[model samples]
Target: MGTREEIAFDRALGALIGGALGDAMGMPTQLLSPAEIKADYGFVDCFIDPAPEHPVSKGLKAGAVTDDTEQTLLMASVLLQSGDSFDHHAWVNALVAWEKDIKARGGYDLLGPSTKRAIDAINAGTPPEEAGRSGETNGAAMRIAPVGILVPPGEALIARVAESCRATHNTTLAISSAAAVASVISHGIDGADWREAIGFAVAAARAGEKQGHWVPGGTIAARIEWALDMVEGCSIEEGIARVFDRLGTAVISQESVPAAFAVLKLAKGDAWEAAVIAANLGGDTDTIGAIAGSMAGACAGYDRLPQDRIGGLVGIDLDDVRELARALVRARLTDEKARHG
Candidate 1:
């Protein structure tokens, strides 16, 4: 591979591992307020086992990841498995199979509200295009890094994001959030500066908001800009505090997605820093951390992450996505026609 291709490959793998890192780091803290996180874990700088009372993650290990990483990897696998055709049935089947595996392992039920509702809708005979008409949550955006890795920003990325969202997160806010996250990753893989990648993400959000069925919410692009502006010039602690209080850290697409962008800025695009910050930011911490970590990884590549933190991400066997990450970069590098809509 040439220099550019090699770089892309590294960033793609970085996105995968970075995602797992953040997901696992935040697994134990989800649903707590920032104060609660501080009180319980005394600032989550590393992976710690979930509190016994954590509804979904209590039974898992310190470095265990939740549905954010699982769904992202599952989407990546389905994207590759479906080849050029985007087999809808295959996608749904993959989700179903994943859900089953979680159950068999006695893993806590981790499907986000939007995902569960959409799947239920589809199983009840809702049309694919309509099943997720009301899904305006973070579920779609959390699993969208693969699209970013495989497709360039602009119309192609928007179209691919639309396809990725249609069956489970079809609403405007949800699609826009996913596009924003994916665009940042895509631009990072393409060698854009971190701030430049955020610009690309805003543009992608604008484009993506037009694709899915309309839903009432603040414009995702505008929210991202507001988020960055709100935290500009703040120290890391102040930035995290401002984001947690003002921007929110909930599951709504408007809240969590933009909060992630803000986290990326605060961390200066360091995957390890981003994960640390997001893990302590409280509600929906895992997804927020995962998104920021994915973008940071895409911007800087796996080599840039801290060596110590890498050892803690063992619960998710990141080797599973290493080869897949390379294949994605290959698709992007060759201008593969198979990637086209």
Candidate 2:
């Protein structure tokens, strides 16, 4: 492959694999307070299982991914199977099936509140389009990296993110946040620098926020802007403190999305550093780490991921992730070529 294509391939691999690595790295600390994480394991830098007292990830093994990576891979699978012509009904069905499998397997770290509510609605005979209308959490944004890598940076990409998110997170805030993440990933895969990529992400998020069905919440764009403002001239330590202390790491789209962006800003787009820093940030660590890690990984490419972490991921295989990334790149390239030709 040419240098350009090779770079895209590597970035794509980095986004997905680094995302999973970050997910696993933060598993133990997912529900812990920053103080609790500090008390239990000062500065989480390795894969560790959740503590017995942990609310969400308890009983999970070290390197076991939570819902974030699980849903990401599911989305990737559906995206691959559908090619460019995704069927929204099939996508919703896949989500329902995945949820059933998770419940059947006695998965403790089950779906997030927004996703769970949407799935429950589906189970209760609600139509697909209306099932997820009330979801305003970060669930859609957390698992949206595959969509980012699959689509280019444009209105079309934003629209796709909206469509993909509406089945489980239809709110303007949720769709906008998801679009921002996907746009960033798309820019990163296309070899854009962090600042440029983030710029595109911000713009796309604003545009997407205007398009989705309205729900009551602070807009993701405004929150991200506020987060960026908070870190404008602070030291890294201070920036981190500000993010964790004030920006928050909650499951809500407004909180987590901005928190992820704050960590990314603090880490200066270094995938490994971003992931580790995010994992250590306390609340909703895994999801924040996954989001930040995907962006950082896209910017830095796959080589930035730690070799040891890659080796430790429990159920996820790095090789498989790499192969999937390559396949996505090839398919996207083929589609782009066809469109241009």
Candidate 3:
């Protein structure tokens, strides 16, 4: 076995790559129902080309990622450039530039509803803080694995996630959702199994709900437990179906985030299996797949991922992810040493 630092670095890289792999795997089936997905590609266990009629991902080759991976890379880039200091203005600027770049490249980018509105408002000179107050979607949660890589789990993780999410998902549910995903990834990087990580994820969700603008919905923390509890004894197929039908798979933070965790539970922390389940899961497939993938990959480590998909991902840099993961761990270690001293 590797040393603790070596393990953290590998798990951090695994989280990023697994997110991209699942994003690509689910891209074609993103908005389609399970019936629709089955009609088109059957199981969706591997990378396949998006259909010509695909709403968001047509004209791209197999293994091409969608907005989920793009925004994740965007968050990673900003975090790396700024180090421990976060600049809201700079982050907004990056979002604007990303959209502009997308438009320039033929306008096929699938920005989520909350993110699109926040970006438009920010471009029109609204303060980023106020612009996202009403936002409540999984957009924040879908791309927050980078924050997990940067911080260890605890109050610091929750606070950092709030800052990253405030620009596009400022509502209580949204922040809590992101916190759950990030918390899982953080704990996983520290070598916790899904059994231990889920408890921490629930704690983080509760803490995060206290950060953003208050909104009334089923508590994210409660739904995570509820979603997992309902699917406890069932087989993989039954669990995924229960999550899809009962827990939901919509873009709402409450639905999709819990759905991701449910898939993770059924997949038992296997990155490849989680991706397969999430890819075929129907609504918000790419985001759900990416979220589950990050957590599972981090806990399971790099060796457990699908090598074919790792080599197949398009428009992503594995080498860059490797370097970024190392840097993030180094930064975290420095922070810990300073704090203890």
Candidate 4:
């Protein structure tokens, strides 16, 4: 690999590993308010199994990651096979295969309601496109960081991958949410300035909104606008507090996506702080943490993450995620060269 290829490979690996580590670390205390988490565990730094007293905590002891990581791995596998192109059929097949695996595992499935519905529709012979026109869940956005890493920057590229997200999450809001997150990842991989990355993300979100997916009553755009406004006016803590106050514990795409972006902005280039703050925001903690972690990981890279903290995850191998990221970086580079050379 060339020097540029090596750097991109390393950055992508850092992002994938950092994302998983952050996901596992926050799994136990997901969705708890800052005060609630403080009162319970006094600061969640490692992968401690959940206790009986804590429902979300109890699930953690089982070493189970919610739909966030599972879908991410699934999406990565699909993208790897597609060779940096958008193949709708392969995407559907991979999701179907994942659903089968989930069924075989037999306990506490990670497939969300919307994803399940889409899978069922596909099983019933519905086209992949129409199968995913369900509610606007954050499931689509949660697993899309890899898409950002693999694809280049362009609305067309973003839209193509965003449509792949629609194979399960078809709502305009959900599609837009996925694009917004992917755009951030693309810019991060390209090493754009943080402010420029944020601007790109905001533009992507607005474009999605323009497609009529952003409903009238939805507060997602408003909240995102508010977050952007607070960029210069508030401390990270204050900004987090504001997001939590304005957008509560609901896990819908409208609530969670904006909140995740808010926390990402607040973290200000610090992955650990960004993740922890997102985790302590009180509801949908894992998803929020995962999303924020993706952004932070992309910006800070894996080398910047603390060693002691990275050592704490339980079930999954962070090394494998890094390997996948490296492979993906190579694939992205090869494709880029083929197209432009």
The residue-level lDDT of candidate 3 at 91 comes to 82
In model 1, the Cα lDDT at residue 85 comes to: 58
- lDDT, candidates in the order shown: 0.87, 0.83, 0.87, 0.70
> Which tens-of-lDDT digit does each residue in 127-199 have in candidate 2?
7678788999889999999888888888888888887887788888999999989998999999987777888
Candidate 2: worst-modelled 10 consecutive residues by lDDT? 83-92
Tens digit per residue, CA lDDT, model 3, 234-322: 89878878988898999999999999999888888888788889988899998999999999888878877888778998878778778
Clashes of 2: 0
> Taking the tens digit of each residue's C-alpha lDDT, what string does model 1 give over 234-338?
998899889988989999999999999999999888888889899988899999999999998998887877767877775566567888898888878777545
Q: Assess the local accuracy of residue 335 in candidate 2 as a C-alpha lDDT between 0 and 100.
A: 75
**What TM-score does candidate 4 reach?**
0.88
Where in model 1 is the C-alpha error above 4 Å? 336-341
Stretches of model 2 off by over 4 angstroms after superposition = none
Candidate 4 global lDDT? 0.70
Candidate 3: residue 112 Cα off by (Å): 1.2
The TM-score, computed over Cα atoms with residue i paired to residue i, of candidate 1 is: 0.96
RMSD of each: 1.9, 1.7, 1.3, 2.8
Query: Would you estimate the TM-scores of all the predictions?
Result: 0.96, 0.94, 0.97, 0.88
